[model samples]
Target chain A: MPVEKLIFYAFAALMLFAAVRVISVRNSVQAVLFLVLTFFCAAVLWMLAEAEFLAITLVLVYVGAVMVLFLFVVMMLDVDYAAMREGFARLLPFGIIVSLMFFGVLFYILRDRFFGPENLPPPPPHGADYSNVEALGEVLYTEYFYPFEIAAVLLLVAMVAAISLTFRGRQQRKGQQVSRQLQAQKSDRLKIVTMASESPRKATPEPAPTDPEEGQS
Target chain B: MDALLAVLLIIGKILLILIPLILAVAYTTFAERKLIGYMQMRIGPNRVGIRGWLQPIADVIKLLLKEIVIPSGASKGLFVIAPILFIAPSFAAWAVVPFDAGVVLADVNVGLLYLLAMTSIGVYGVIIAGWASNSKYAFLGSLRSAAQIISYEIAMGFALVAVLMAGGSMNLGEIVEAQSGGIWHWFFLPLLPILVVYWVSGVAETNRAPFDLPEGESEIVAGFHVEYAGMAFALFFLAEYANMILISVLTALFFFGGWLNPLQGIPGLETITAWIPGTIWLLLKAGFFLFLMIWLRATFPRYRYDQVMRLGWKIFIPVTLVWLFVLTLMIKGGLPPWFGEAG
Candidate 1:
């Protein structure tokens, strides 16, 4: 077998195994890690298929940023395994139905009529100088510009929504104003009052008549 | 046999890169110590060898000989894997780092992106180590480190985007070639703000001071690696140092014109310095940045956690974004001398 073929097979096998493990793992952290592995394997598969730009972007965006945040939240959560498992049996049938429906839809879309080799032959391979980034950028900027812009705007909106949802108004919180602190001058913090130096006073002897009444008492 | 020869040849090239890189990392530690020591009016580790030249070697041997102690309740598999996971990406990122003109392991078109991805993946090691250790200090340290890394990554990415816009290519070699004329033609002159953001973010990303709040000794003991000992702990140290060197090298490559002679445009100096190798120039540039890293460590106090976050998210990100906008305008308007031909 060709080296590429071998690599593809290995990554494919790993992806499948990781995907299975993601569902099967009891530990939330481990499950998230398995999912990450699955994504990584998928990215490698994409690389093998000569989609280097997409492959790296997938790793960069999903595995690097999104999944790190996912793992962060999952790791921090104090999950009750017993409570989580309680509804598994009750939800199994519903889950099976939903997944089956989803699979059926995918099958309908990806059936031989639409996606077979006869209908859609593989793309011709480009030369060594061919840049996936440039090609993708050309198409994205020219052909699908409006859609791309719309998607970007949608993401912006989502980001804004998330922030706004979480943002509490600045209640009378004592937050550090770093700029103000940095701009502070010596005079603002310390005032050196210039005064005449006080002369040391010698201890005076008490007069005998000052406490005459007390002594008499 | 031909295929086998090719594989061996590739392996040889990798070793050529890795050997020097590992040595550089080791020496960076030595340099950091000696430099910091000098700053504080003291000599560091002179007992190991002459002027402490063999200090890193001794440290390495000691670490190797020591037993890797696992905490009683620590997750065994992950505890072992975490350091490897962290160190692997730092090494892997070297694959695309060009030393001289066209001297790279894998000159992939998406080299910059690949580096970004690889570096970002390193946070997992810290997170995993923290979680597996089952120690509050470790967990808190990792969380802080990971959050810091993620925040800084955005600013770093934006800075790289500015570089990409200015250079007109993702290939590191191509980026260097674009700045061929002289130091004046380098992206650093036009993208000064971006360069500052990139270098600062790079420092933060590596968890170095003044951004080294992740390993804040006073607060979290040893941070994420609190439970780690011996070789395992050494791996984290290795990864951090390796990352520091990588960032320095990358800053050189992106801004200082990697492997390009700085005296190129100067008439007499150019001819005089012609005998000097490009790799040396690259090293010198990277070495200066490395010195700066240590210098900063010695000079500055560690940033408070909130301040570090504010600097990354509020300050650096916005700076990069504004600079990126300005760079885009410069590129579009064909601004003279630096970016006239960039469009």
Candidate 2:
């Protein structure tokens, strides 16, 4: 086989292993890490398919941002493994049925009858100067412009919703007013108070000492 | 046989970049020490051979000779793998960096995106190391570092978006070529605010001083790598320094014009400086940024954790977003500086 084929196979194998481990791993942290590995391998596979833009974006978005947050939460949570495992036996039948149904759907859609090489031949390779980013951008901006804009708006709305849901205004809560802090001047912080120096005190006359002789006697 | 030769050639090219990079990383540590020392009025690392030039080598040797002590409760596999993970992306990102005109390892079209992705991947090493160490300090440090990196990454991404708008290309080489005329044509002047945001966010992203709250020694006692010792610890150090160099080089590449001569338009100096190689110019710019990084470490105090977050999220992000808007207008309106420029 060619080098590209070999690479694809290697990454595909690794991705499969990682995907399996993501669910099977005993430790949640390890599971998350495995998921990251799976995403990375999938990205490599995408790169092999000449989808460099999509591949890099996948690594950039999913593996980079999303998975890091996932790992962050997973690592912080004080999960009880014993408690989590207690439901495994009870959930197994339902889980197996659901997974099987999902797999069947995927297999049916991906069957040779529809997605065979006869029906859809491999795309002709582009020349060296062909830019995946430019091509993708062209399509995204023109043909799918409305859909893209809608998706972006949807994400923005979701973000606003998330922020608003979490946000609360409390009178007692104190927070850093960064702008006010930055606006503070030296004069505002310090006042140079000047006062007249008064030092001299009036001298009082001393009484004559008569106790020394009497004490000695 | 042809395949073998090609593979060997690629390996040779990789080494050509990697060897110099590793050496540069080592010297950057020495430079940081010496620069910061001079700034603070102290003699830095003059004990080793010939004014302590051999200090980095000696330190490496010492680290290599010492044992990697894994803590009792530490996850052995992850503890071992964490340093590797940390350092791998630091080196891997170099694959996309344009040294001179057309002088790059990969030269991928999405080079900037690749660099961003690699840097993002680096946070995992810290998180894993902290978690695996089973120490509170390590975990806290990792959490802080991860959060800081994630927050700053958005600002950094926005800064790069401005660069993309100014340059009109994602390719680093193309971006450099876009600013070929002179210093006036560079992205720094037009994208001044963006550059500032990028530079600051770069520092924060790399977890350098002033933004080095993640490894705040006084508070977290060395943070995420607290339990790491010897070579394992050295790996993290190497990764940090490597990342610092990468960020500096990227700052040069994105804003200052990678491999492009600054004195291009100058009549007298242009011909005189033309003899100098592009690689040398690139290195000089990178070196200046590196020195500035050390200077920053010396000059500024570590920002409070909240302050760092506020600066990244509230300040830098807004600055970049506004600048990006301005940049978009410029690009659309065909204004001066980068107007009618090919990328």
Candidate 3:
């Protein structure tokens, strides 16, 4: 077998193993870690497909940022292991049936009739100094420019929406505007203290008795 | 038989070089201290090994003799692997960095790209160390480093692209060859903006002072390597210094003509220094840049996190990009007269 095929099989095996571990792991943190492994293996497969830039982006963006955030969330969450496992068995049969059905459908669609017996297509002889990123940039700008701009707009809109939703004013919590605070003069927080003279003497007064038949007046 | 013998010779040479390289890295620390100390009004190490020339060796012995204490909660395997991983790539990148016309160990077509990839992978070691240590400080430091490297990588790549455009090749040797003839032919004059951007990005890339927030002492408490000690800490230090040298070499190679005589338009001086070896010139140029780097570290203060990002994205990237476009146009049109009639 070719080296490419060996790498393909290795990465494929890694992905499957990682996916299985992700589902079966008791610890949520370990599950997220397994997911990262799965992403890494996928990135390797993408690299084998001659998508070096995309592969690196996947690692840098997804594995670097998304998985880190996932790990943070998973670690911070107060999860009860017993409670999480409560309905797992009850849901297993149906979940497996649904997943197996989806897998069968996917396999059937990707069978010999669909993909044919075509071997791995040999990559074109790359130019001496050509970069995948450069090619992608050219294509994106020339052909897909409008769609790219549209997608950017959509992302911007979504980002704005998310920020707005999360940034609602709350009456209970005190929030400081850093810009305003930075601009604040020291005089605003400062005060001058002065001492006044104290009174020299004070008198005590006796209380009149009123109880026990008017203090036997 | 010849190929086998050649391989053996190469391997032997690597071994010889590796031992000395390690020793050189050890003393580089001492040199840095003494140099910085001299620059300031302070006395550096003088007790160990005759004016502290052997201070690096003494320091190495001390680090080696010291016991490596593992934190109770740390991941033992990854914690051990991290420093080695970090240092290995730093040394590996030097494999392709040409010292002279034919002195490089490997001269692959994708030499520059390979360097980039190797340096990029270097971050994983840092990230792993931070994660494995399970320390908040380490984790924060690593996170900051990751962001910093990734952000500046874009600007650095742009700056490099400008160099590539000017040189018309990604091969370092070819780049050096292109800059032959004179100082005016150096890419620094034509691509001045890019050179500045590249140099600044190089500083950030090396995680040096002013951009060394990843290891900010006052804030994150020594940053990512907070937990590292003994030889492990030494390895990280070695990697950092090695990276600094690598960046300086790259700066020299790209902006200043690598191994080329700096006498352009001056007929007498050019002819005189034409006989001087290229390696010496290259070393001198690289050394000058290294000194400048140290000088910058000594002089400037660290930038805040936001400021670092702002400088990279807002200032460097756009500057490099526009300069790249300008250079591409200039090179495409024709060489300027000052480029000295193109060999």
Candidate 4:
């Protein structure tokens, strides 16, 4: 078999195994890790197909940034495993129906009706020095500019929504006014008030002001 | 036969990278300690060998001799896999790091993105190690580290995007080539703010102080790998140093002009510096950055966890984003003579 075929099969097998392990693992953290592995394996498969830009961006965006947050949540939350599993039975039928519907849509999309290799084979791989970044840039900025702009705006809205949903301004916690701190000078917060020694106020006779005898007297 | 030889050659190249990398990782730890020691007006680890040069090796043997300890309630598979997960991506990142002009293992088109991705993947080890250890300290450490790394990664990526805009390529070698000709030609001149931001974020990304909230000894008790021991612990240690080296190399490449002599613009000094090979210059520049990192560690106190987060999310991110925009404009305007070919 060709080396590329060997790599393809290897990555495909690993991805499948990891995909199964993602759901099967008892530990949520481990399950999340397995999901990461699945994503990574799929990226390798993309690499094998010479879609270097897509492959790297997948790992960069999903595996790198997004999944770190995913693992972060999974690792930190004290998930009650038994309680988590309790709703599985109730959700299973709905899950199955939804999954089946999704798969049906995918199948219909991939079938002879709209798309297949018979209809349109994948684009030929580019040689070295063929900058996929430039090609993608050109296409995104020109042909697909409207869709791209809409996607960017959608992401902006989602970002605003996420912040608004989760951000809570609390009065309890001490706030750092970074700008004020940066702007402060010694002269702004300090002043000299000279006084005559032993004139303004007399020292307390007893240093221990908290003495019960003194308070009572 | 040709295929076998090619495999052998690739293996040899990997070994060549590893041999130096391992040594550098080992020595970087020693250097950090010694530098900190001098800053504090004391000697560090002088007993092992002459002036503690062999201390890292001695430390290595000690770690190697210890038994790998697994906590009773820890997840077995992840416990074993965590260190490997941490170290592998870090070492793998060097594959695309150009040592000299045209001297890289994998000259991928999206080399910068590849490096960013590898760096991003490294946080998994900490997160996994924390979880697998089944300790609260480790878990907390992992969480802080995870949050810290991701926050800084945004700034780091934006900084690199600025570099990408100026260089007009994601390839590392091409980035270096664009900064060729003179010291003034370096991206550091025009993109000073981004350079500072990148290195600061680099420090945070490497989990070094003052951004080391995850490993805060006073609070977190070594943070994510609190329960790790023997080689398992050693891998985290190695990974941290390797990451430091990675950051240093990247800083050198991006801002300082990797493999380029500093006095390139001068008439006769250029010839004088040309006697030295490009690789040496690259290493020297990387070393300077490494020393700068250690100096910062020695000088500054550790940042409060909240402060670290604030710095990354609020300060660094906005600054880098603005600089990235300014960088695009600068390239378009052709304001800097050195950046004439950019954009």
Task: Please write out the lDDT profile of model 4 over residues B1-343, one tens digit for every residue.
Answer: 8777988999999999989999999999999899899889999889988878899999999999999999999988889999999999999999999998888998988999999999999988888898888899998898888888988999999999998888879999999999988888888988899998999999999999888889999998999999999999999999999999999999999988999888898999998878888899999999999999999988899998878888888899899888878777888887766566643
The sequence of per-residue lDDT tens digits that candidate 3 reaches over residues B125-195 is 78768877889999899888877887887888788778877776667887888887678778888888888
Which parts of model 2 are misplaced by more than 4 Å?
Answer: A193-217, B341-343
Candidate 1 predicts chain B with a TM-score of: 0.98
The Cα RMSD across the true interface for model 1 is 0.4
- Model 4: per-residue lDDT, tens digit, A79-188? 89898889998999999999999999899888985685677887877779898889899999999999999999999999999998998876686777888998999889
Q: What is the lDDT of residue B337 in candidate 1?
A: 64
Best by lDDT: 1
Task: Return the TM-score for each candidate structure.
Answer: 0.94, 0.94, 0.75, 0.91
TM-score result, candidate 2:
0.94
Preferred candidate (lDDT higher): 1 or 2? 1
- lDDT per residue as tens, model 2, A70-96: 998888799999988898889999999
**Model 4: pairs clashing at backbone N, Cα or C within 3 Å:** none
Instruction: Give candidates' CA RMSD values in order.
Output: 4.5, 4.5, 11.1, 4.8
Clashes of each: 0, 0, 0, 0
lDDT of each: 0.91, 0.90, 0.80, 0.89
> Candidate 3 — which residues are off by over 4 angstroms?
A1-86, A113-217, B1-21, B102-110, B264-266, B321-325, B328-343
Chain B: TM-scores of all predictions: 0.98, 0.98, 0.94, 0.98
Candidate 1, residue B227: Cα displacement in angstroms equals 1.1
Q: Report the lDDT tens digits of candidate 1 across residue range A157-184.
A: 9999999999998799788788899999
Clashing pairs in 1: none
